[model samples]
Each structure stands twice: as structure tokens, then as C-alpha cells.
Target: MPEYRAPLADFEFLLHDWLNVSEHYAQIGKDDIDADLVNEIITQGARFAESEVAPINQIGDQQGCTLKDGKVTTAEGFPQAYQSYIENGWNAMLGSEEYGGQELPYSVAIPVHEMLVSANVSWRLVCGLTESAVLALEKHGSDELKETYLPNLISGEWTGTMNLTEPQAGSDLSLLTSKAEANDDGSYKISGTKIFISGGDHEWTDNIIHLVLARLPDAPAGVKGISLFLVPKMLPDANGEFTIENDLSVGSIEHKMGLHGCPTCVMNFDGAKGWLIGAPHSGLACMFTMMNDARFQVGLQGTGIAEASYQGALTYAKERLQSRAPQGVQQPDEKADAIIHLPDVRRMLLTQKALTEGSRALGLLYAKQVDIVRFGTEEEQAKAESIVAYLTPITKSFFTDMGQEVSQHGVQIFGGHGYIQEWGMEQLIRDSRITQLYEGTNGIQALDLISRKLVRDGGRMLQNTAALFSDMINAIQNEADKNMALEIQQQWLAGSESLMSGDAFDTASRAYDYMQFCAYSLLAICWLSMKDRAAQTGNDQLASSKAKTCDFYIKRLYPRALMHKAALGDSGEDLAALSLEDF
Candidate 1:
């Protein structure tokens, strides 16, 4: 099996040097979480992930999940491993302390999450979805709901799943046909089938809390009529004892291309007892609260997978002997030098490293903004929200795309061995393929970027974002670092200018390309920030490596934004002109 190790140094660099997470937390009134504690959490989290979680990745993938008699059983060792996870208090690490949680900031939780994702994406899904569900319930659920549900969910005795898509409803929730009828006792009966429900049901926990979306009898025609409900596998009675089973069952587990360890269930909620979460006919809004959180983590999945793939491939490259260096024989005593001597191999490795590291830097900073959005003063919260709104889709789409690319490069680096299963390289590719498809596809993410975030506000958010980047650029005094920062600023300005002047349709047509351009340029800015910090540290090797990577990103990757820019300039006539008859 390919070994997985948490990139602790990268996380530390991001948390300590680049972002100054401790000071930022202080600014947001999170005084209790200092840097020392943060580092301890990270250290212990890595040890747990490396020793406990990663060893099961390949085993889980090979064994997969099994279902029989309306019950789902996770692969061998998962339940035990999960018990260890819960017992370690990792599940409640980010939840609120009022309900028996650690109440760690999302910024701290995110690094630990990155480690979990890298060690085992499949197992990570269980806790990741639960945390998101907890966020939604905390944000929108009524007091009664919180009192009853939040304790168990927060304590990790029960897990949670977000049920958004059904057989008829995929991306468009308006087409949902799930029915919810009011009861005399003030509860409701939900009857419908929800597909693609991750961790929908499992024997690892006693109860599974499903945040379901269904329409009321008196509801309107479309999405506006929908409402959110808390439906659990085990319904609590009047005495709040969950001894009774709700009328919900797993129809079957999905035979998927990847993430087989996570049961993608078809949930049949037939007259299931449930209670309303948010206000009636506002289900979509409440679900978005959870989805937005999931989307950020899904984006980080890309970086996590990429990080794992890089580690595996780098190890193999340094050990696998092949042709000698192009310059001269570096290992004359050996039959052949290590594959790391090859230029193209280094290119692939560097590409993977740059994108993975850049994604980490950018993603952690985004999580800090999430912290501000949640805990900052009023003014800071408002500005952080706007920036986060613009960044969400980019992180969701671009990072996952990078994950896919990096996984493929891993396979290429290993050549024939990568295609083999025992090496565990292929598993990374298979696991990463789903990151692009789920939590809303990359295509849908692009539309959100174009229609909702960028164009909806008449490019105001984009401009504000650009101004923030401009401030970073203007702060640079070092000539070379300043040049790199200006390059990113100029590229961003050009892209934003195109988006601002273009019509909605034109912008929408090129949204995918625009997202790539915007993400790449933004990552360049992140690289520049790291570059400046590395230079100040005066560590020769660290500063030199950071400088080289920054130069490589600015020269090799940043130029790709021009391709997106050129593509965005077109009228999109060819696509529009091609009619159904033409095909």
C-alpha cells in the first residue's frame, strides 16, 4: 500500500508564517485557541491519521461496504477504527462546547481535516458530512431541535447526512417530489426516496441524522415550497429515548466508481417521523448553509488527494532506478540512477507540489475567512462573507480539478507500477475522481461562480476581491516579489475587466475558463505571499525552495491564465449556433 503522511510542515507554514493564524484568531476574539494548542492538535491529529486511519485506506477500498436486509455494514476494521476516532474526541473537535464539543475554530479543524482526508478520504466522508450537518443544525434548527439532536450529534454518538438529491432531482432541487404531511402532534411524515446520500446509514453508529428536504402539502409549485426536516434512523419518543426505529430504510448501496467504503445509499423515507428545521418553504436556503460548508471541504479533498499522490510518487521516484541524469552520471556505481534525475519527472512532481501547496495556502486562508465570517466583529464579518462568497466556487471547482490532474500525474510517474493495485497509486486516482462529480459538479460550480457570485452583484464582489489582492501586491517592497505580485494583480485585473464588460450570457458561457484563470492567478498571489515570508525567515534551503517554486508557478502555471482569458473573449457563437438539428 502507498503510505500516507500528513503534510504537517506545510500546514504549520500556512498557519504560523503566511497567515499568522494566532493573531488573526485573536482579532476575531478566539483567544482561547493559541498557537501552541493548535500545533499540539495538529501533531496528535497527524499521528492518529498516520497510524490509525491511513493503514485502512487500501483495505477499505478493496473490501468496500456491504448491505443486506435494509442494513449497511462498513468494511472490516472501519467500525473499530471509527470507534477509535470518536473516542479520541476528533469528531467533536470543531463542534460547540455548549453541547459537549471542543469548539475549535474551523481554521484549526481544517488542517486536521486535511490530514484525515489524505489518510483516508472514504472514512473522512463520515465525519466531514456529520460536521457540516452539525453546522446547519446549529445555524438554522429551532431550539427544541437543538436541545434534542445537537447533543448526540455533537458528541459523536450519532452521525449526520445531508439529503438534497432524489431520483428526479439531481442538480435542480425544484424537481423534487418528496412529500411531507403535517401531523396532529406537530410532527410530520416524510415520504420520498433520496439518492446519493453519503453515510446515509451505517452500523458504526446507533443513529443517523438525515437533514432531508421535502415539500409540504400546501407548498407552492417549485423550490420555494420545499422545507428542511430532521429525520433520524431512530426516532426519539416523548421521553427523548431513541429506542423506536423511524420508518426509513436503505434501499441499497450504490456500486460506484470510487469511494466504495462510503455507502452512497438510496434512502426510502416512508412516512418517516420528522420535525421542521428552519422556517417552512425555506429548505434550499438552509441546505445551502450545510452545502457551502461541505463544498469547502470537498475543495480541500482535491488538495489532500494531491498531497498524498505527491508523497507516494516522490518516494517512488527517489527510489526507483532508471536512466542516468541528462547532465552526467550522478550514481555511477548503480546500474541506473533514480527516476528523480529525469527532467519530465521533476516537472510532474513540481506541478503536483506547486498546485497542492498553493491549494493548501489558499484553502487555509479561506478557512480563516470562514472563522471571521462566523466570529469576527460586524464589519469584519460582512467583508469576510463577501470574500468567502466569491472564493467558494473557485475552491470547489479548481482545487478538485487540480486533484484530478495531480492524481493522473502520479500514475504517470509510476508508469506501469502505478496501474497496479498493490502499489496503491491507482486508488488515489479512483478516489479523487468523485471529488469533481459530487457536492455539485464542477460545471454547476462554474455556473454558481458566474451567475451567483460574480455577475449577480454586477461584479462588485469580484472588484472588492481584486482590491484585496491589490493591497497585498502594493505591500510588497522587494523588487522581485513585487514583480510577481504585480503579475498576479495585472492578470486578475484583466480577467475581472473582461467579466465586468461582458454580457451575462457571454460571461456564463466562459465561466469555467474564467474560474480557472481566476483561481490560478489567486494561487499566484498566495505563492507570492509565501515567497515574501520565506525570504524573511533567512533559512537558506527553505527560502531557496520557496523562491524556485514561486518562480515556477508564476512562469509556468500563471501563464495558463492567458489561455483562459483568450477563450473568454470569444462571442460563444459556435456553441450557440450549433442547434439540435445540427447534431
Candidate 2:
């Protein structure tokens, strides 16, 4: 197994340069962030994840979770670790300042949170889901709703879950049968069965807040009928206190292939007390509020898994003895030269570095877009919102999909030792698999990108994207970054033109596939820009790594996006060409 090291330099470069996150704070009319503060926070964040959580990752996998007749007892040390995570401010990084959050930009939260995911995904999911819940409510919930739950959620005194799936309603929300009946007192009683709800029923908090999808008795049928509700494990009374245990209980905790530390519960609401979140029969829209965040969170799972595997690979490459270097006369004094000298091994390690950090740079940028939308001026806010909507699916799907690929590579690179539990490499592979399945499958993401998003409003989003690319490329050309920026600009144009001209079906997948391409592209640009910015008169290690990664990206991964583009088309008729009868 390889050893794990924080990609601090990569993180620092993205945070300070590509995103220019501090500018986000200024746009929001605040001055709470700067380079020094961002660095300190990230350093502390990495230290906490490495020291407190990383050690328990494999332990959690080996111990898994114990399901009693009802209660789910997580692996030992998990409870304490959860407390430690709370005691620090890690849980509240993105919460509103009014609710005791640092109110820092998502750019800061993005990388720091990725460190946790990379360090211990199974462990961090519980906390990460809670954070997602807080952000969603802050965005859509009423002031009163925010007052009641936001503080506890931010502080991690309580955790949250999103319940949208049932035995029959995984992908098709139209199949959901969860029932919510309205009360005269402006509330509702939610009674339904929800299965495969991650963090649905954890005992890590004083209470669990569930954002469930259900329907009213008089609601319209199908997707339009679905609505959102806030159902709690323990219903709070008028005084805003959870004095009584609500009827929302776990039917069972699902046994799964990975993420064993985060309890996957089959939650049952037997006439549980609930409150409508946004609008009646508009729950799906409101539920998507959190889903958007969760999707990106899932993307980070890919980046996180890649980073963990990369760390192990880095450790293995430097320490593991292998055949002599192909250069013919290197390390004559040792039993064998380190594998890091070999181009293929270095390629695998660099592959992880390039993809994982590239994913980080984009995720951080998207997150900063979220903060900008929330706090920027009117025009800035509108622009941020549009970009966020445009990129959400891509960010979510691409990173997770690619992360799984990278993890498989990471395991293979370690050879036989990678397969065993002791190495943690195989676990990374298994664990990375679920990110693609959750938060909507990557296939769904591709469809969302290619079909829904691209065609919506007659490709207005596509137009906006073209404009951004043009502006960026023009600037790059002016500054001698013409080749790199032009490459991305060309892809953007080709994607948009193909989609609009009825060749979109053959346009490959611009959303997810193009995202992976642009993920590296944007990061390379951001990293290069940041390196240049950080050293007006001196060199920066972060920038140096950035340069290497950018080169690797442009020279290798960035161009590969063409293959996926080559794969897209107008219909699945070709795929349906195969017949079950023929088989």
C-alpha cells in the first residue's frame, strides 16, 4: 500500500490562484478571507483530517457497522472522531455566519472538505451530508426553519439526511409513494417508506433532520405531484426544542459493498410529524436544492478516492523495491531502484495527481460560484447562478465517474499488494464505485448535460459558455497563453454548434465528458495564472506543482476528451439495435 500525503501545494494553488476566492469575499461585501487565512485554515483542516480521521479509515472498513435489532452502532472510534470533527469548526465551514458558521467561501470549503473525503470517505460522509443539508435549508428554507435547525447542523450537534428513494423509486421520482397529509396548523404528517437513504438514520447527533419527498392527498399525479418536507427523528415543539421522539425510525440499515462506516438506512415514517419545506407539491424542486450540493459532494468522492489512492501510490513508488531502472545505470548502490524512476509508474502517479487536483480546482471554482450567487451584486449574482446551474451536473458526474477510474488504476499500480485489505488500495477501488451510482448515475448526468441542460432555453446556457470561453481565450491569446486557451475555446464551440445543428447526438457528452476535459483545462489555466500571480518577485512551490500538472493535463488528459465527444449522438436507436429476442 502507498502512503498518504496531503496535496497541499496543489490545493493552495487552486484556492489562491484559479478561483481567486478572496475576490469572492470582496464581491459579497466582506473581508473575512485572504491568502494567509486561507492557508492557515487549509493547513489546520489537513492536519485534522490526517491526524484524527485517516487512521480510522481502514479500521472502519474492517469493523464496518453493527446493526442490532434496530440501532446501528458504527465502528469503534467513529463517535469520538465525529465529536472531534465537531469540536473543531470543520463542520461549519459553509454555514451562515448567523448560525455560527465561519461563512467562508465554498472555495475554501471545497478543498478542505476534499481532504476529509480523501483521508476517510466512510467517516466523512456523515459530516459531509450534514453540511449539505445546512446549505440547502439556508438557501430555500424560511427564517424560522433556518433558526430551528441551522445552528445545530452547523455545529454538528445534529446531523441531516436526504430521503428521496424508496424500494421502487430510485431513479423515477414518479414512482415514489411517500404520503404527506397537510395539517390545519400549516404542517403535515409524513408517512411513507424510504430505502437506501444515506445518513438517514445515524445516532451521531441529538436528532436527525430528514428532507423527504412525498405527496399530498389532493396533489396532482406523477412528477408534478411530488413535494418536499422536513421530517425529524424527534419532533420539536413550539419552543423550538426536540422534547419528543418523532416516529421517524429506521426499518433497517442496508449492508453494502462500500461506505460501510456511513449507515445506509431504510427509514420508515409512520405518520411522522412534518413541515412543508418550500411549496406544496414542489418538493422535488426543493429537494433538488440539496441534491445539487450532494451531486458535487459525490464528485469530490471521486477526487477524494483518487487522492487517497495517489497517496498510497506515491508512498509505494518511493519505497517499494522493483527492477532496475530502464536507464541502465541508476541506483547501483541499492537492492533495486524506486519505481518512481520508471516512466509508467510515474505516469500512473502523475495521472492521479493531474486528475484528482484538476477535479479539485474545478470543484472549488464551482463552489465559489455558489458563494458568489448567494452574496454577490445583482448582476454578479445572476451570472453566478447561471453558471452554477450550468455546471452542477458536470461537476457531480465527471469527478465521481473519473475518480472510480483513477482508483482502479491506483489499485493496479500497487500490483498484488493493492488487492489486500492491508493496503487500503482495493478499499479505495470498492469505495470509489458508489460515487458514480449515487446523486444520480453518471449516465443520467450525461443525459442531463446533453439533453436537458443543452437544449433548455434554446441553448442559452451554451451561448453563455461560449462567451466565457471566448473571453478567456482572448485574454490568454493576448498574454501568450493562446494555444492552451484556444484548445478549450475550440472544444466549447464545437460542442455548442454540434448540439444546436442536430448533430448533438454525435456530439459526444459535453456535460460530463466535456466537464472532465474542462476540469483539467480550467485548472491548468487557473494553476498557471495563480503561479504567475503568487510570484511577482519570487517562486512559489504551489505554482511549480501547478505548472507540472498543467503541462501533464494539456499534454495528456485534456485532449482525450475528444474520444467521449466522438461517442455522443442524437439517439440511443443504435444502442437499441441489439434485440433481446436476438440474444
For all predicted structures, in order, the TM-scores are 0.98, 0.93
Model 2 Cα displacement at 340 (Å)?
1.8
lDDT digits (tens) for residues 411-496 of candidate 2:
87788888888888999888888998988988787667666667654676666655654554554423555565666666655755
Worst 10 residues of 1 by lDDT: 495-504
- Shift in Å, residue 467, candidate 1: 3.6
Which consecutive 10 residues in model 2 have the weakest lDDT in total?
501-510
- Candidate 2 ranges with C-alpha deviation above 4 Å: 1-3, 237-240, 469-480, 501-537, 540-544, 569-573
Model 1 ranges with Cα > 4 A deviation: 501-504
Model 1 TM-score (2 dp): 0.98
The top-ranked prediction according to TM-score is 1
| Structure candidate 2, residue pairs in collision | 2-312, 227-283, 228-283, 505-568, 505-569, 505-570, 506-568, 506-569, 508-568
Q: Tell me the alpha-carbon RMSD of every candidate.
A: 1.3, 2.7
